[model samples]
Target: MEIFPAVARVTFDGQVRSFDPSVERTEMERGLPKQRLLNSQVLVKQSMTLYFASIGDATTFESWYFDVIKRIGWFEMVHPYSGQTIKARFENGALGDLVPDEKLTGDFKMDTVVEYMR
Candidate 1:
């Protein structure tokens, strides 16, 4: 699998991570709901907004995403929480939108959502 191209020069900001635990639950009429763990492993999903100081870096990422990542349908990236290289796919199989930031001088921004998979 191809690894995702890095575009961020510094830290990844505005990142949101969600953990979906496998579970089964049953509602009781007179008492608290009962739940059981279906699997020990939890699914991870992340949404990140990346900042690029250089337009060249942002364009590089866009080219890689279209040429490689889109074709492969999945890629490897370092998980922020786990700090390990993990296989990931674009959330809902959609490419992120790259736009120039007017608020920041000579900067670009892109937002992406990815789901980690085994």
Candidate 2:
């Protein structure tokens, strides 16, 4: 799968701006009387945000993304940072927020964050 192409497009959202994804590794640990021991260590979450810049792009993105949010499932994407294809979904709350900047009346940008377990 193609990782982050300087700029890339997805099956759902076309022509997007993406930055390096955030990958997290988390574990549970406990401390003993004399030493420390690890309990559970595993990859926790991988997250990335895709930006839809432009009113037309934002509108299309909103429709597609909100649709996914309504359903309870994961979508597919090529992770930008890890260079791997992963099953991901929109981050828990507030799927997409589109607010027009002062410079343009209709021009706007919206960012959608997604998370994956890999």
Candidate 3:
């Protein structure tokens, strides 16, 4: 399994978590609705913001993102919300952009969304 690049001295923001349950529902004409789980495992999605303290750190991550992930489309990393290692992929095939520091400093920030593939 390929691990995400561990850029040093980066600040990690709290993850915004969401999930989609694998369920099917049916409504009876004269009774309560019935639901059944199609799959045991749900799909987990998380959005995370990373603040790179330096350009070097940002470049390292960018390289890995484009070279490794963009090609393979998925990788293993520690889940920001669950605190456990999981297989993940870029959400909706969207590759996030690296925004530079507003003050012209050699810093960068990136907001990314990842889906947990159980």
- The C-alpha RMSD in Å for every predicted model, in order, reads 2.6, 8.3, 2.6
Give me candidate 3's TM-score against the actual structure.
0.81
- Over 4 Å off in model 2, which ranges? 1-43, 46-49, 68-71, 101-107
Worst 10 residues of 3 by lDDT: 8-17
lDDT tens digits, residue span 3-107, model 3: 877882224564687888888999999889999999988888888877777888988877887777774477887766557888887788674677886645887
The C-alpha local distance difference test score for the whole of candidate 2 amounts to 0.48
Per-prediction TM-score to the true structure, in the order listed: 0.77, 0.50, 0.81
What is the number of backbone collisions in each predicted candidate, taken in the order shown?
Answer: 0, 0, 0
lDDT, candidate 2, 7-114, per-residue tens? 223333333434333434445475433434333332334333444346667666555545544534566666665557777655564444555645556555445566
Give candidate 1 misplaced runs (Cα > 4 Å): 8-10, 102-104
Where does candidate 3 stray beyond 4 Å? 8-14, 101-104
- Alpha-carbon lDDT, every model: 0.76, 0.48, 0.74
Residue 102 local lDDT, model 3: 65
Model 1 residue pairs with clashes: none
